[model samples]
Target: MNATAVTVFHRPPDAESFEAWLDWMGETAFAAEGFVECCRAVSDDPALEPGFSVTFRSEALVNEFLDSAARSRVLAEGEALGIQRKSSDLVIVEGELPPPGVGVFHHSVADGKAADFVAAEAELVTLSATFPGFEGVALFCRGDTGRWFSVLRFRTAQHLSDWMRSEQRAAALPALRAELTEDFSVVAHTTPFGSTLRTVDGRTRVTPTWKIAMLVLLVLYPTVMTLSRFLGPVLDENGAPPWLAMWLSQIVSVALMSYILSPAVAACFRRWLDPVDGAGWRISALGAAIVVVLYALTLLLFATVKWLHYWDYNR
Candidate 1:
C-alpha cells in the first residue's frame, strides 16, 4: 500500500535559508527509494506552521527511511535552524536546513557592541546570498546566557566550505572579528566513509558490519603479508631502521588499499557486500562462510608453503 508522511514544522527565522534547503531536499528526495512525489505547503498566516508531505510506494519503504542514518543526519541540520519536528520523514518547512552549515559556531560579541555585530551580520547575510547553495542565516540571542548566536545553512558541505574559505569572507573577517570578542568559529563534517556508501531508491544503507569486517580482513591481510614477504627484506638490507621500514611498508599497503585493492575487492564482492542487493541472513551467512574458508586456506598456504616464509623472521 502507498504510504504518505506529512511533517509539520515551525517557520524558520530565516525564510531564505529554509527555502534553499527545501530546494536541495526536493532534489534529494526524488532520488530516494519508492519515491512517488514530494509536495510543499506554505501557510499565509504567520501563526500557522508550514509543512511538507512525501509519498512513497509503500508504507514499509517510508518506515525504512525513518529508521535510516541519512534522515537522522538531515533532521539534525533542520533542528539547528530553529526548527522543531514530530520525529518523522521530511520537514516541509513549507521549507529547513542541511546541517548547521558553516558559520556554525557562535561568536561572543564585543562587550557593548552587540548592535555593531548585528549590523555586521546583516552585511554577511547579503554577501553570503550571492554564493551557490547558500541557504539562509538565523541570528538570535540566547535567553538564558544572553549570548549572540548565528546559524548559516548551506545546501551541502562543499558549498559551506566554499563560502567559509572565499576571498570575500577572508576580507570581511577583520570587520567581523572587530565586532566579536573572540575569533569566528566554524564546524564541519570531514568523514570520508559516507561517500563510499550508496543511496538506493532514495534511501541509503550501510553494508552489514560483519560483511565489511570480512572484506577488510580479506584485502588487508594479503596486502600486509605480501608487503612483508617482498618489501620487508629489501628495506632491512638497505640500512633502513625497523620503524622506517615498517612505515614504508605501511605506506604501500595503504596506497594499495585506498587506490587498488579496496576498490577491486569491493567490486568482486559487490553483490555479497550490498545491504540492499544481498541483505538476507542466509546470503550474509553464505558470504561469511566463504570468507572463513578462504581464511583457513590462506593460513594453510602460508604455513605449508616453504618459499612464502623466507622473510617471516626478517619482517
Candidate 2:
C-alpha cells in the first residue's frame, strides 16, 4: 500500500461560507479520490485562519487517480470556489500500518498533574526507542483536563512487554510514580479496539481533535471552580433561583457550552477515528465523518428540543 499525504490550504475570506464550502469540497474532492479522512479545522486562538488536511492510501492498481484527468478537474473546481490552489500539496509518505500484536496504553492522570504525566511519557519514549519493533509513539493530552492519554504502537506485544519489563525502564519509574497522585493502570491490547480506526472514501483520518479539547475543558473548568471555592474566601450569596429558573439556566448553559465547544470536539473525532490504511472493509471514513458531524450537529438538535419544550410548557 502506498501512503499519500495531501494538504489543502484555504483562508476563508468570509467565515459565513467557510464551513459550508469546506464540507462540500471535502465530500467531493477527497471522497472522489478515496481520501475521506479529512478535517476542515481552525485554530483555537481565533486569530488564526482555518485549513483542511487529509491523508489517504492508494494501492498500485488504482493509484492513477492521483495523476489522472480527474485530478485536473478537482483542481479547477477548487479554484472556481475561491480556494487558493497554490496552498495545496500532495505527496506520498511512508505510511505504516501497525502489524498485529500492537498495544495501546491509555492513561488518564489525576486533577492537575498532566504535565508530570507528559514528562514521564517523554522519558518512556526515550527508553522505549531502544526496544526492537517499536514502530512509533503518539501522545495526546487536552488543555482543559489534567488527565493524559496516549497511544503507543509496537510491532508486537512481546516487543512491548519486553520493554515494559526492562530494568532500565523500571529505573525511571520512581520519578513518574512520585508525580502521580495514584498508580496509573495500563491496558494491553493485542489489536486496535473501540472507534479508533475508520476509513473514508479511500483515506484514513486520525482521531478527532475537538473531543480532546472538550475533555480537557471538562476537567479544567470544575477544577478551577473547586479551587476557587476551597482556597478563596466567599463574601456574599445571592438569592437562590426557583426550580424552573434553575432548569432553564442549566439548559441555556449547556446550549452555550456546546456551541462554543463543538468545533474542537469535531476535530478530535477526525483525529482518532481515522484509518491507518485502506485494507479492510470494516468501516469507511465517510461513515465516521458523518457520525462525527452528526455528533456536533446534536448541539443544534438539543437546542431545538429545548426550544420546543419551552414553547409547550409556556403555552
Candidate 3:
C-alpha cells in the first residue's frame, strides 16, 4: 500500500468553532476510503497555526479525498469562518507502515566522533532488529547542529520497553555514552494503537525525573491529605463502609491529580521543568525550595487543625 502525508496551514477566527470543525474533519477522514490514521497537534510554540499529519493506504485514495465534495464543503465553511488557507502538500511515502510504537532518539554526539557514532549506531540498529518487536530504523542528522536523531519503530509499547530495558541495550550503553556530549533524550507522543516519539521544532521537551517527582509530590500530598482529613468524616457520616470510603477518596484524589493538579503544577514550573542549556543551579534550587515551602505549610495547617480538635475534645 502507498502512504501519503498532507500538511495544511490555516488561521481560524474562532477557537471553539475551529476545534469543532477539526473534530468533524477527523471523523470524516476516518470514514474516507483507504483511511489509515490522522494525527493533529496545535503548535505549542505558535498560537495561530494548527497542523495535521494524515496517512492513507494509497495515493489514489488521497487524490479522491482531496477532490471529494466533502472536502470542498469543509473548505467553504473554513473560509466563512475566516480561516485562510496558507499551503498544503501531499508527500508520497514508499514503504510499509511503521511499527505501532515509534521512538525518536536524539543524541548530541561528541565532536570528531561523528563517524564512530554512525558505525556504533549501525551495529545498534542491527542488534535492535534482533529484538522481538523491531520493525524498522531511520537515521537523521542536522548539518548545522551535528546532532543525530534516530527513529525506531516497534510492535507495541511493551515491546519497545523491553528493548529499551534489555540486557543487550545495557551492554552497549558504555560505548554509546562515551561518544555523547550529554545523555540521549527521547520524546514520545502516544496514540490509541501505540505511541510515536519525535522531536518538536528540532528540540525534545523532556522534563527531568527529579523535577517530575517534585511536582507530583507537591500536588499529591496535599490532595491525599485534604481528602483524608475533611472528606473522610463526611463519607463515614453518609454510612459508607471503611473500605468504600477509602476507595472513594482515592478515586477523587486520582481524578484531581490527572485532570487538574498535575497540569497546573507543570505549567507553574514550566521554565524550571524545561530549563535552557547552561542554566544555573539557582533555578533548580528555587523550584525545590518552593515545593519544600508548600509541604511545610500543608503540615503546619494540618497540625494546627488537629491540635484545635484535640483541645476542644478535652474541654
Q: Pick the candidate with the highest TM-score.
A: 3
- lDDT by residue (132-240, candidate 1, tens digit) is 9985555644443425545555677677778876889777768778877666533222111111343322234567676777877877887787788888888988999
Off by over 4 Å in 1: 1-196, 200-202, 311-315
- Full ranking by TM-score: 3, 1, 2
Q: What are the Cα lDDT values of the candidates? A: 0.63, 0.47, 0.64
Residue-pair clash count for candidate 2: 27
TM-score, candidate number 2 = 0.30
In the range 1-315, model 2's lDDT, one tens digit per residue, is 434333434454656665676566555556555563544432222222245444355543135545556655655666666766323343433323333434333355666666566667677677777789775454543334544434454567677667666788778877776656655544211111122343222223444454344444543343333333332222113343455445545554455445544434434443333334322344444544555565566446545654433324423
Which pairs clash in model 1?
A: 17-135, 17-136, 31-202, 32-201, 32-202, 33-201, 33-202, 52-92, 92-95
Q: Per-residue lDDT of 25-130 in model 3, one digit per residue for the tens?
A: 7677788898887655323323213545455888778778777788778778877887665554434443222334665566898889877776677677778788
Give residue 7's error in model 1 in angstroms: 32
Candidate 2 lDDT (Cα, 0 to 1)? 0.47
Worst 10 residues of 3 by lDDT: 189-198
Backbone clash count for every predicted candidate, in the order shown: 9, 27, 0
- Supply the global lDDT for candidate 1: 0.63
